[model samples]
Target chain A: MLSRNQIKYIQSLHQKKYRQQHGAFLVEGAKSVQEVFQSDFQIEMLVATEAFYKENTRLTDRQRTPVEIASVADLERIGTLESNNAALAVVRTKENLPLLAGPDEIALILDDIRDPGNLGTILRIADWYGVRKILCSETTADVYNPKVISASKGSFTRVNWWYGDVAQFLSQLGDGVAVYGAFLNGEDVHTLPFGTSGYLVMGNESNGIGPAVEPFVIKRVTIPSYGGAESLNVGIATAVLLDNWRRTGNLT
Target chain B: MLSRNQIKYIQSLHQKKYRQQHGAFLVEGAKSVQEVFQSDFQIEMLVATEAFYKENTRLTDRQRTPVEIASVADLERIGTLESNNAALAVVRTKENLPLLAGPDEIALILDDIRDPGNLGTILRIADWYGVRKILCSETTADVYNPKVISASKGSFTRVNWWYGDVAQFLSQLGDGVAVYGAFLNGEDVHTLPFGTSGYLVMGNESNGIGPAVEPFVIKRVTIPSYGGAESLNVGIATAVLLDNWRRTGNLT
Candidate 1:
């Protein structure tokens, strides 16, 4: 059972301002909440249906986190997801760790990916491709948004993400670190020689790479389109590029 | 100006039963509405702000469709999209054209892709990759769903989609036409040789290729995952497989 104030507090985390103010955000749905529960992220509150609570008795018993048994109506009232009848959790947002791209690792640099779903899907893609870190422009969608967390399908627990000025971050990279920027008229990615470690910069959904980060791109690569569609979705484009990198790059 | 009856009617089309009864589905937002306006699909009604109406003078003048000047509030009230301030069109869903897999063309076969957004994104990917036709399971998300139309980003206009039994359709395909189905433990796609034209089967989001359609697949291919992530989204997997086909297949 949730009190009025508890429900209000959970609802407030839906907004970015409130999430930042409270230093927490929502991880909604059964799959995401279950994944976060097993992850290292600290949980503040776990609101779940009787079924979910009963299914995970061991974790619920071990954790000192406050657990609230919620009805489907209560979850719909406080949670962000439309079909969240299972569970919702309030998780403490971790501080962005000071991390740098390693010499032999691939990282994704997102330049103003605005859609929360796209951002989340990209994180899942990164996790699938073994790309550890994602550097995002400050303009990118909030990682802690409920939509992002839900769309990520639990991969959010593995991928480390940080947001900063894309240009400044790219400039600070080690000398000779190849920066592959996705472009409309670049070298064919199928044939391009990709280094083992590099930052693959993907741009805004509508606009390609912005002018600010374009100069830092040492190599430009493009996925050759065979059809008449103007562009691929940014998330789809990222997965294709990452697949090519794994296939042809030194990392393989 | 939109009448209260017209508003209620438009809102009703949001449901599958009403859309079938009315034989129309909404194409919302300026980009999608503009694309559908120019497509072969007949438009029953064009609901637009004065701004959109004034800008698209040629389309409005030529078409016999009823034009309703609607406030942003009316569009928001009736449309499925949260940010549909520009335009919405009531488009008559076209009859499924009888299509067959050509000897020199690739096609996508979706097996119960349940998410409207995934179905829409797959359509866009198909359009981009030049895959002209898609054969979907009868259980697949409705192509005429407003969410599918919105997520397709106007690519729905180009891709031809059909719904039917997966096994029956595959059994009827011409001999020597390869069928590439995405699987977890299939051949590594990087080294796999692909034919010019074939059916690429993508399965449901969670369950993957259904058991009913598994027997019809000639070749099983998978995007080799380098990370610890469990699986790629069905939509992302489709793009990667299409990318590989374009690169290695005889089509290119």
Candidate 2:
């Protein structure tokens, strides 16, 4: 049973303002909550149904955070996911640590990716491809958005994301880092020669890479389109590009 | 200006039952409406703002469909999209034609893809890779769903989808066609050889390829994961597999 204040507080984390103000965000549904419990992030609260609490005796026994046994209805009322019957956790948002890419590491640079779902999916894709760090433009969607957390499917725990001015970050990387941007008429990604380490820049959903960040891009890569669609979804494009990069031995 | 009955009818199409009953679905927003207007699919009715009507004189003049000039507010009120300001069109759903695969075409077979957005993104990816036909399990999300239409970004016009029992259809296809299904522990896709013509089976979001359809899959293929993610999004998986197929000269 959740108190009225607890319900309201959980609901408030749905918005970015409250998330930032409280330095906390929500991880809902069984998979995400379980992953968060095993992660290094600090958990402030855990709300779960009796069935879920009973099923995971290890988790319930070793609980370092406050656990509130609630009904599914209570969990749904306080959570963002429509079908979250298992668990919800309030997790402290981690600070953006300085990410220094090594000479043989591939990092992602996102420019104004507005959709939370897309951002989350990209995080999962980055994690799948062993890309540990993502540099986002300040205008990109909040990494802590509930929608993003839901879409990331627990891979968010392993990936680190930092938001800043994308162009400034790329420009200041100096001469050693290679930068590749996805474009419509760019060189075919399959045929393009990729260095072992670089930053692959992906642009907005509607607009490709923004002009301000174009100068920082040393090479423009494209996924060849054979049919009538205008463009692939941003997340899909990123996954395909990363697959090719990894397959062609571009990532160490 | 939309009549009250027209508005109600448009709103009814939001539900799958009504769309099936009416034999029509909506194409909302500027990009989708424009694309549907140019497609071979017959448009039953088009509602648009005066600005939209005036700008596309060719479409307005050669319109065989009924045109009703409507306000942007009306479009937003009756449409599924939250921010459609330009146009909406009622398009007749096309009949599912018998798809015959030549020796040079690669097609997609989807098993219970429940998310409309994923289905739509799959259609766009299929269109991009020149896969013109898709076979879906009867339990797949309706292709005519407004959410699916919105996510397809006009590629819905180019792709043809058919829904039936996936196993039954594959069983009937006999030994002439190669069937590849994505599995977690399957053969690595990059190292696998794909023929020019075959069926690529994609499965459900949470549950992968169902057991009922598993026997029909002759080849199990998987994208190798280098990082910690357990799986990929269904739509992203489809795009990556298709990219690999096309790049390896498996598609003519």
Candidate 3:
């Protein structure tokens, strides 16, 4: 049985302030909790239903993390997902170290993306396309948000993210590294001469790339629209752009 | 001011049974309500704040749509959106008649896409890529669901959809029209020889193309994964596939 204090503490982690103060975040639902064990993040504890605990005892023991068997109701009460019958985990937040493009690697830059679901979907998309590092603008939705984690479908474990000033990061990029930004009026992504390695930046949902970051973009690319859609969703735009990037043999 | 009976009537349309019985659905939020006026849909009634009504008097007058001046609170209570400060409209749902591809026109087939948001997002993506007609399986989420309408961000105004047995529809497809189905193990979408005009079939969110619909696929396509991520969201996959289709000069 979870003590009231324990349940309150877990619930507190749902907000940014408590999460930052405790240096921990939540991984909820069956798939995400299972995958978090495969990640390098430090696990603080796990709360799971008896059925889930019995099924995953070996995985739980292998991680050497404390596990508390609880009812599905308990799990739902402490987590963000509408229906979580499996488990929830409290994981230590990783240090926000700097990440750069390795040779022949494409790094993603997210500029002021405010939606947690969009952020999570992008993480999954980036992971599918082999983008290991994501540079997020500080204004972007918190990577640790449960909504983002839930939407990521456990991809948060595989992708590394760093939050900072994206404009500064772009300005300091090494010579010969190109920067591709998605824009309404830009070079058609299908025909653009993508470099061997660079950064592809996506902008906010309502606005394109902010002025602070626009100047540093070496080339602007567009997934040419053929119909009446005013804009594509940011996550959808990211997948299409990354797909074209990999399709052009830019992926290593 | 909305009558108590009228407010209760709008709230009833939130459910599938009521929506079908009433033969009407809601279009909420500033953008969607504004765009619905441009669509061919019959406007039953529009509820708007006094400010919105004053600013859009010409537009409200153009369609001869009945208008009810309401507060934001009334709109929030009557609509599904958490925050709809501007307007909401009661739109007549279209007939689910048959829709087939035109010459050199691409059609979309959705097999059991269950998520309302995913269905709605797919509509927006299809609009962006110029895919006009969408054929949905009977099990797919209703296109008129408010969540779908809200997530579609006004694209429902442009795209046409038909609901029926997709398997039967595909089987009865005219000769020589190719049907491309997305699969994890299939021809790489990047290099697939897309036909001039055909159907791109997207499967359910979790199960992928249903067994009933799978046999109708003339060719299977995949957005090749380069990383450890297992799958892409259905909407993301749709965008990538359509992007490749358009990139290959198949969009006429």
What digit string (tens of lDDT, one per residue) describes model 3 on residues A1-252? 888999999999999999999999999988899999888889999999999988988887787999889988888888888898999999999999999999889999999999999999999999999999999999999999999999899999999999999999888877788899999999998787677688999999999899999999989898899888899999999999998899887333
Ranking by TM-score: 3, 2, 1
TM-score attained by model 3: 0.97
lDDT by residue (B1-252, candidate 3, tens digit) is: 799999999999899999999999999988898899888889999999999889888887899988999999999998898999999999999988999898888999999999999999999999999888999999999999999999899999999999999999998987798999999999987777787788999999989999999999999999999887899999999999999998887333
How does model 1 score by TM-score? 0.91
Model 1, residue B105: C-alpha shift (Å): 0.4
Task: After superposing candidate 1 on the true structure, give the runs of residues whose Cα lies further than 4 Å from its correct spot.
Answer: A1-8, A60-66, A250-252, B1-12, B63-68, B250-252
Instruction: Tell me the lDDT of candidate 3.
Output: 0.92
Clashes of each: 0, 0, 0
For DockQ, candidate 1 versus 2, the one ahead is 2
Please say which candidate is ahead in DockQ: 1 or 3.
Answer: 3
**Candidate 3, A44: how far from true, in Å?**
1.4
Cα displacement (Å) at residue A241, model 1 = 1.0
What class would a CAPRI assessor give candidate 3's docking? high
